[model samples]
Target: MFPGSETRAGRLLVRARRQGVLLSRAFGGPEPGEALFARAPKPWMRLLPHFLALAASASLLPTTVVVLLGDYGLPGVLAGLLGVGQAAPLLLAGARPLSAWYVVFSTDVLTALALLLWGGPLDGAAWPWPAPTIVGYLLLCLPLSLHLARRTLVAVWLSTAAAAVLVGLLRPGHSPGSSVLLVVLSGVVLLLGGALRERSEAQRRLAEQETISEAERSHRRLLEERARIARELHDVVAHHMSVISVQADSAPYRVQGVPEAARAEFTSIADTARQSLAEMRRLLGVLRSEGTEAEGGGAGPELAPQPGLGELGTLVESAVRAGVAARLTVTGEPAGLPRAVTLNAYRIVQEALANVVRHAPGAEAAVTVALSADGSALRVEVVNGPPATPARPLEWHGTGHGLIGMRERTRLLGGTLDTGPTAEGGFRVAAVLPRNEPAPGENA
Candidate 1:
């Protein structure tokens, strides 16, 4: 023999040993991962298993006793004991099918052996599997088919067929048709039960996939809203930078009798401002290109000016016209603040009132604007009471991103926002923004 052939044969032997161990484990009692019969969803369907078990027990117990006593002439005590053993297992088959099957099968084999050994003259009686035993076995197989793994099911069916064949060999004179009938009917029940289990599993997986898809779409919308805010801020800063560059370049010409040294200083300021502007435009170009791609290639940034605190009165008026008793109040002297702060503040109020119109129909709303005592921060609050009447159903539902947009705006300005329900069953939204831009690295 070649040297390599010995090594190959040894590897094959190890593989075969592993497979044999797995097969043996499959034929044993139920493992930890095996599926079991689940409770039915509907309230009425849940009682079906109990009803079937009761009906089967009532009918099979008496029939088995009659057959054994009249046909086989067995003693009353032995016949009653065997009848109870075969019929009792059906009650527990839904929860522990494999253990129940073991009990039922053992009783069947013992009864057949008892009839073969001590019985009346068997002149045309069914020897091995009588009608009651076959019915009980088939009933147990219903739950087994729904719960057992494929490997375990195959092992069980094969073992049952093998046992039937051996018993038929022992009694050649009795009818052989009972064994054939039991095997064929049990096979059909298993096939139908397996198909139903597969269909239920497929529906469960489809529902899970739909939930995951909805979450992904919501996350994508949040990212797009943030990008839109960034683009608008970029335009505001660019406009201010352009004015500074033009003023510096023409400074010397505006003032008469200027020194050369000071003129050279103005030129240097203009050069630095122009360089910064160029870099900012390049970055803005990349943002716009990406936005265009996302929007199918035809979208552009809005050219109209962004709104500020001056526009709050118009927003409140529109809400008032739409059935809400809305009021706007100013508590402190208005101070000149950064454009970004004012823009975000206006948007926060706008969204708050819109929510009132949509959710709290016919409710009273109050909008308050105040400046801090030290004049370093601005506070804006909007509160609305509970609805006075039932809200009418509208065909269009919102995208559910209003709160997310408000939170994002506050974070960008390094400010804090608080929102919650009020004591009188109303909602309140409050925000505090710095009057000036935050110091470098302060937010970090």
Candidate 2:
């Protein structure tokens, strides 16, 4: 009936299912003392198991049918059950691998026992080392190596070896040599599986380290930006405050109507401003601890006597020479005012004039500083027409920081600023500040 042909085919089918091409995806293990076991497996690796399962089902099912057709004198039911059992483990390996291994092992041992009890049923070669036995052992070993832990693999391998030895010793004709071979096969499968596990673990660690490094870089950038803002604040707000302090300190002798008490009051404002300036400098120094000047460079920009409302004429003259038909006019009784108000008025005019030169080249402009009749507030306005030669506006783009600086300055000093294009095809920036703010420690 050509029964050996069917039996040999079944043996090969089972061996292919266990410790076959799918399990031997990478044949060699890592060299001793190598850094882990290389990298991750390919993305298509999961598909390999399903392929093996398909091939195993095809081969194992046919072998069973052939054996049944031959009518090996075994019970028809037993022959059918044996075929189903052999294929079941290979099919089950996809989802429930460990259970599949146990099924393969149990079915192999029981089939051998059943054949022995039936008194040489089917005339197959050995008791347990038959075609089904080899196939079932391999099916268990391949997937077992994949899913089990290192220690678990070791335990399973040892257990399988012990079972093989026991089967050989207990069975009359089974040899110790086949049992030894089975144990060696189990060890080889486990070594392959351990190497893959190490590779997967190493990849996970590398991904984690990349995430941490990115977070640290983002935090470093945030700190650098904050330091830059501190330097700008020191330049704009602190500079003006210092000028106010100096002006108030010397106003008594410079002016005729100031009383001794008013002089002392001015002295107090100057002392307070100086102390504030010192604290601000210390804060700036701390922010700049990252490096020298840390982006703003040294001592801010130097100027002649900290120019303010007093230098409005010089600023206008500079604007006129730059080709803007410029005018500066002072209105109302121009008395001494808070140093902050004076500095802000001068800067507002300066930035507005600069914008006209840049965005509205060849434009007419006017600068006006008007003190209120009651001397409670001061208003500064600069207005410029749109570029006469629209084809070529000045292109040396400023840092885009001029207007932001102006707004920040007005906001900190408790002032209101309005700026935008005017209905006359021109631009206007108007700011008003309280000329007589309450003295330090005085209620607003």
Candidate 3:
């Protein structure tokens, strides 16, 4: 080759590579070269390998170049070019690291062979690797330890040792002790690599287990919270319910000169109140006993799944039996609603129907359950038409808490409620609860 031809040739190759990149981009297709870039090692672990390679290449390349320039002149510059070539493997360590080592191993063996054929027979400390070989293998192995699987790293470690030994025993200048040292140092590189791989794997497993444990703890906390709410409110509400039942039962018996029709109406009120109290007691008992029941594994009876709108039929029948003619109509597919939405819907309807009986006895009430088209929310409307034939009802005075309870239930479910007298002198209670909303003030 001519003077400066090697540098010129290197520039030509680089220019060709860049031109190819432009053509690929212009034509609009994936670049194979980007495959190397895409798989680069993550940031924290990447910089060290490349920096070590840079230091090694800078140190060894100049020495090789000066020595060869004096001996082989232009040809010696080619040998120096090979020395500078160690940078390729170092830079590639952030991406295709193991590939770089394979290249380094082959190049060192070839460099040692070239020393025999062209640089003269092995005669000094520089026979096998010289400066470039030592740095190439050592720096390249650092990333291999971090990224490569254990079995692959072991194979590389063994092959590196064998190649060094073979180069020393076959070629003449190097002693047995130097070959042994090379093997020892190469094995240490691999051991460090394996240690890094194992530590990273262990950390990943620990993270996954911690996530699962946290989810389980969250679920348990929710159940305990619901139980706490049940324990606090059960007795207070139950007392009011019991009083309502007692009054509804004894009022007609105590009053003088009442018609058979009036007595039947009083009987209906007592029956409806008793049924509601029984159901509520069972539900609250489930909550109150949750802590003991879970611990003792049979300390109390198991309750059915929580009430939802599916129980609306039973509610409508109970309302009818209580002298208020009631029926249920569902609009939209319903598909289903969230558990909290369903439970609150049932409660809201129960309260509204009870109001129909209390405020407008013998009124015709229609309960409509309309799930929104998007299934994101549900609209419940309980409209009771005016009572049949105006008459004086039993001086009806009861706790003012019924409407308050309805509002509270609606608010906790993150829903809307509108209750007032209709234009036709009937009462209407309407609510719209969004699906899967967090229960206000407690777990849903």
For all candidates, what are the clash counts? 0, 3, 1
Clashing pairs in 2: 14-135, 18-138, 18-139
Best by lDDT: 1
At residue 442, candidate 2 shows an lDDT of: 20
Q: Pick the candidate with the highest TM-score.
A: 1
Better of 1 and 3 by TM-score: 1
lDDT of each: 0.70, 0.61, 0.61
TM-score of 3: 0.51
What is the C-alpha lDDT profile of model 3 across 293-379, one tens digit per residue?
A: 444554343332455666788988887888766778777755445455666677778767665665555454343434342357778
lDDT of 1 by residue, 226-309 (tens): 876777787667766776777788889998888999999988888888888888777766666352533434443355567777
| Model 1: lowest-lDDT 10 consecutive positions | 1-10
Better of 1 and 2 by TM-score: 1
Candidate 1 Cα lDDT to native: 0.70
Error of 2 at 417 (Å): 25
Give per-model TM-scores. Answer: 0.64, 0.50, 0.51
Query: TM-score order of candidates, best first?
Result: 1, 3, 2
